[model samples]
Target chain A: MTETLKKFVAGLELDTRMLGMIGALVILWLSFNMFTDGRFITPRNIFNLSVQTASVAVMATGMVFVIVTRHIDLSVGSLLGLIGMLMGTLQVHILPQFLGLEHPLIWVITIVAGVAVGVIVGAAQGWVIGYLAVPSFIVTLGGLLMYRGAAWWVTTGQTVAPLDSNFRLLGGGAEGTLGEGLSWLVGIIATIAAVVMMVLSRRQKNSHGFKLKPLWAEFTLGGIVIALILGFVTVMNSYPLPKGAVRRIYEARGEEIPQFAVMHGIAIPVVIVFVIAIIMTIIARRTRFGRYVFATGGNPEAAELSGINTKLLTVKVFALMGALTAIAAVIASARLGSVGNDLGTLDELRVIAAAVIGGTALAGGIGTIYGALLGALIMQSLQSGMAMVGVDAPLQSIVVGFVLVLAVYLDIAYRRRAGQ
Target chain B: MTHANAAHPLVEMRDIHVSFGGIKAVDHVSIDVYPGEVVGLLGHNGAGKSTLIKVLSGAYKRDAGEIFINGEKVEIHNPRDARAHNIETIYQTLALADNLDAASNLFLGREITNPLGFVNDDAMEAETRKIMGKLNPNFKKFADPVSALSGGQRQSVAIARAVYFDARILIMDEPTAALGPHETQMVADLIKQLKKAGIGIFLISHDIHDVLDLCDRASVMKNGKLVGTVNVDDVTDDDLLSMIILGKKPGEETITS
Candidate 1:
């Protein structure tokens, strides 16, 4: 590579794994777009894809920390199921009996109850793994079965349904999307925030008496970020709804078709994903806790000798995983407008696959939250694209499995070349 | 070159004994290191030098012994307790987080933080650069993880971490074992600087040249038992060798203890 190209890549401050993940995502999107005859890249499909990718992406962020710590949580999917059932019970049955369905308190109480249950469950499992010295794989594997069985027992294999309107809104139903104008404003604010963060970090690096990246490089990065954010907002703002829905009111009054704004912008789940991703990235990059996590993962004995409480860090990572799983449970159940005994079945594998595809090593000590998010998006895109192309469901699974293995194999090869 | 009077020993290990599965790995060994002194611990592999030092560094719980730091009895149940008393150990393995950058590894368990409780990476990198400037001026690759670093550079990072933490007592296990000649000289310069600052160091080594050149005193162990500690100027290299091989000190006749 040329010196300038090397400088540009270095100045971006992204490791090769992140760049690889992004490259793979772009290629996947383009290939899917071709397969779907341009439909995969359409605004509506993209918006729906973003919504579909949110839950797995959220859990994948937490899974990065878990897997980085050289552990796994096989129970997240079943845990999501159990938590979703609890959320259903709280919102659909139990809460209405005490507080009226329309009362705003019901929402707050149900959400809190769901999250609290997740935390307690997660922490208990973590404690068993950390303090009791049980291997994490066996413990969580047991939890997988227990939580799944409990989800079924909670309603005797019955489905819980008809969640409140506010809950459904959180899942990106018609009422859940931000309008175009608000989305544009949000886009601008986010761009400004990105630029400000960049400037502040560069200044901080300068103050640290280190070599600074060239100003042109920084400006180029800032420009790309702003363009991407604005472009995304533009796409989301232009999703054309069905003509029938737009003209129904006019047709009812025997009138001409009126220009109608589409029912789309940024869905609540997408916003949730973005916010969670940002927070998780910061925690993984900027916090002392994050450093300890990486250290423990890289060399546990070294970390312990350095005086870090690796056991507590393990518990905390798992608890965070559980908490995110709960959030995923809420969004998933809300999206379907009901909770089933089999809710979130097989989701744990998907989340783990996403993290691995994003360059998180099973051997531990390396991963990025954004990479995992993009990994989740890539998988979602492939699924949605294949479905649109009329591929069989079983064939889709085989392809995804092969892609996952290929991604990991390529990552290992890249690392070997880099001599990691 | 010795301040042998009045200044108390920085750390004193008395009759320390540690066992594994009913076998004495470190037999009743007593050692003391004074401030501004470099005590070379010479022994063969599995001669118990590492285990003996591990007792003081709290890497192992002594089956029988007492440890005193600065003339006060201190109980060290773990590495944290050793760190609490400013005792730092650099294992032969270097014990660095390989996936972390030099700054992150330098400040690994104890990171400098901003008011928001976030690890101040900039401040850490700055401090790391400043310290490396003092210890090893040629170290410039702060952005790369320590795993990508050369052996000499990795050794420099480990040395810098212990030195930066203001460790009053330092234990180095075969620090130069994996290093090149130039890097070994760099470490010698570091030991001199640290010595001038009154930091006591226990230098464990199998290299007689390193021990003779860098240490003020030499103590040899055989089969988990201390043979004797001799002033470098008072004993020839042959005498140290005899003490190590035969577990018998020079000028001793009909004496076995």
Candidate 2:
């Protein structure tokens, strides 16, 4: 039976560690659902959880690269706060003076400026850590303090409110959804992409005369993926828009409200997370830059000797981290409909925890984008689950900390036993 | 050796000097390698042999020197520059990215990529299989990271990397130090094969037997300075050892060939 189970897992090409993590997530969700008397597993709660996880999840994907290269970015939270404040000011105070109120370009210009500043700041920190030969810990820790102070200085400790309506859609609230039809369209397209990718990869392997997984296994894996994707779409599509939101949407469109309740399909921020995950996965698995990143992390001396410009690569990785943090800032501040000094405060810890819990080793040279996404989800679930069960915030944090350490410990033990 | 030397030497590191913090690690070392010849660099641990070779391999910049490739004055400021000139080095540490599979390590700097610039890992694996099949037919762990491989297997990965690139000047630093007798013999055969292909090789080894068995010439270093270069046919193991240990050349520096 054990042999058969092993074969089954191998056939499906499933990572046992990932499977274990998925199992833990399922158990956590189910237990929480019971504790909250089924409230925790509802479509509304799950949707909120996904949206809440988006900012950290987005940052976590970049953190995989940062940590896989055996570095840390403790300044991500502060960087996000700074960028968010800067973008907030641009949208409210500056862009209006230049382009008039409610101009279409205000949001676009704000986002581009935020991301640009993010990359510049990130690359600057990277330059110091790379070319200057400073330890990443010391450098980013300084950035943590510096950027936070800078963020406060941006608005002089005042909260920026009443952001542009369009910008707020990125934050994934009642108005930040794709609606039912668009969500199904995205789900269908994603499923088709997944299938095509698998078939193309299989064909490529075949051309090289490499061993292929069994046809049944391929079908089974495909089935599982399709089920998961469609299932998520269905769940999102099931959650009806609140009566007030439905009326507002119709009134804005200058149409009478429909008789049927409209579903608030996938949240926009959640879609952003999915898109980032896909792009980051492709970058990590298929690009030479990604290959070099892993190689440099694996052995700095070997990578340098192999003619890889590792110092420059460090700068690029950190720059990528900065850009991602900017995206997170967009989601975060938009979600709140305002930007404050406390925006993304302590988010560095959450992002790092998400990456570590997702199986990124601190020692470097090993991580996955999907692992981080799932890790973020798991973390959010734990916190919200405890909250639903009426646990105090302090207790929730304590439990979350224990889980993080325990998960890493368990992952280490698992890897040791697996002899990898 | 005379016939091989009749052609222009493939690599010449003239008056190479390197120092660290005022300490001369390699003081005025000059060496030349002819195509299809193996020149063994003999020295004790701190004798500057590795440092001199590192300059040629582009691991270190010379404090003062000139390097010529195929009789052309060349600049080699980095490992990429060295590789651009088809110079490959298998260091004492093997220099394999431990977390990457053998194929990834083999084609690291020069990966086989699609037109889109994405790494074609399958193509690289196929190429690695073809090469490893030739080098070590028993090597089956192409899918696992190099870290998971045994010492000899890891050695083969490093060797495969250097050889696969069609290097004109190959530097092997104690290639067989981690291998068993059988694997050592395998490397010896590989060296002979590489030599027959007209590759110029710099073999750095403390093993007198390895030098005597494989090298056509030997250059010994002591106190960051060259003792002298000698024809392997004219020197016994004792003569080479004395040159390494006592910083003295043998009785006569004659090329009988």
Candidate 3:
């Protein structure tokens, strides 16, 4: 039976580590559902869980590259806080004064300004790390403190609120989602794209006379992917809008409320996370930049001898991390409809934890964007699960801390065994 | 194979000087190689042979010198510039990224890309397979990282990388140090083939036998200075050892081709 199972796994061409992580996730979800008496697995809770995971998950994907390149950005959380504050100030105080309070372009300008600040600040820090030859740990730690102070100074530690309504949609709410029809359409299109990509890759391998997976194995993998995407879309489409929200929509539209409720297919923030995951995965796998990052991490002298501009690559990687933090800030602030100095406090730890648990080696040269996303999901599940089980805040923190160490220890053991 | 005397030298490093802080790693050292000629660089530890060659390979910027390729002066401030002039080096350390597979390390900076500018990994793997098949017929572990390979396998991977790029100027630093006798013979044969193809090679080695068997000429360095250059046929093992050990040139009576 073990031999047959091994053959089945090999036939699917799946990474054993990835399968293990998925298995763990399923088990975790089942236990959580049991603890909540089936409440945790409901469509409503799952949707909320997805939205909650989005912000950290987005940043965690970028952290994979950072850690893979043998660097750390201790400043990401503070950077998010600073960017969120800047954005809140722009949309709330500055832009409204110029654009006359509710201009269609206010949200766009605010977002652009926030992202610009993030990239510039991030690149500046990268310059110091790469060109100045300073350790990344020290530089980003300084940035952590400096940016947190800067965020506090933005509004003298006061909260900025009443942001532009359109911007809030990016944070994902009852109205900030793709409806039932659009969500299914997206899932179908994604499924088709994935199959086409697999087929094209197989053809490419064939042309090059490389080994290929069997046809039945390929079909099975395709079937699995289709089932996953469709399953997710189905769950998302089952969650109907709350009664108050439905009534408000009718009242705003000057129409009587319908007897039936409309489904909230998928949150905008969740879609953003998925899109970012796809883009980051492509960048990590297909681009020369990604290759150089890993090569430099593996051996800096080798990369330099190979004609790679490793210093410049470092700067670019850090700048990319900064940009991602800014996006996370947008989601965090928009979700709350306000920005405070404490908006992303302690988020750096969560981001790092997620990346580590996802199997980004601190020693550098290996990581996956998808793995980091899954890691973030696992972290959020643990936190929310504990909360639903009425665990105290301190106890939740203790469990998370223990789980983080345990997961990494297990991952290291797995790697040692598989590699041997 | 004999290099043409009248042919322009494939590589010329004129009066190269490299200093680190207050120490002179290579001082006023000059060397040249003609097409189809292999010049062995012999030296003691810290004798500055590698430093001088690094100037030519663009691994180290010379404080003072000019590099000429095929009689034309060229700027080689970095490895990219060296590669542009078709110069490739296999260092003593076999500078392969340990985390990457053979194909990734082979193509490295110069990857095979599709029209969309994405790396064409399959094409690179196929090319790597073809080359490794010729270079080391037993090398079948293409999917494993270089770190997992045996020392000899890793050395061959480094050699294949330099050879695959069609380098006009090849630098092999202790290329056979990690190889078994059979692999050493294979490399010697490969060098013969590369030399017959008119590639200029700088072979750095501690083994006098390898120099005698493979190189056309030998250049000895001591205390960051070149002692002398002599034809391999004109010098015996003791004569070269005297030059490396005592900073002395071969006796006048020993000057014979």
For each candidate in turn, the TM-score is 0.94, 0.98, 0.98
Q: Which regions in candidate 2 have their CA more than 4 angstroms from the true location? A: B2-5, B252-257
Summarize candidate 3's per-residue lDDT along B1-257 as a digit string, tens digits. 36667367889899999999989999888899999999999998898998988888889999998888888899999999999999999999999999999999999999999899999899999999999999999999899889899999999999999999989999999999999999999999999999989899999999999999999999998889988999999889999988888788876444211
Question: Model 3: which docking level applies?
Answer: medium
Q: Write the per-residue lDDT of candidate 2 for residues A1-420, one digit (tens) a residue.
A: 999988898889888889988999999999999998999889999899999999999999999999999899999999999999999999999989978988988888999999999999999999999999999999999999999999999989999999999899999989899999999999999999999999999999999999999999999999999999999999999999999999998999999999898999999999999999989998998898999999988998999999999999999999999999999999999999999999999999999999999999999999999999989999999998998899999999899999999999999999899887
TM-score of chain B of each: 0.95, 0.96, 0.96
Provide the TM-score of the second chain in candidate 2: 0.96
Evaluated with lDDT, which candidate comes out highest? 2
In order of TM-score, best first, we have: 2, 3, 1
Residue B2 Cα positional deviation in candidate 3, in Å, after optimal superposition: 3.3
Deviation (Å) of B73 in candidate 2: 0.9
Predicted structure with the largest TM-score when compared to the true one = 2
- Sort order, DockQ high to low: 2, 3, 1
Worst 10-residue lDDT window for candidate 3 chain A reads A411-420
Clashes of each: 0, 0, 0
lDDT of 2 by residue, B50-141 (tens): 99999988899998989998889999999999999999999999998899999999999899999998999999999999999999999999
What shift in Å separates residue A88 of candidate 2 from its native position after superposition? 0.3
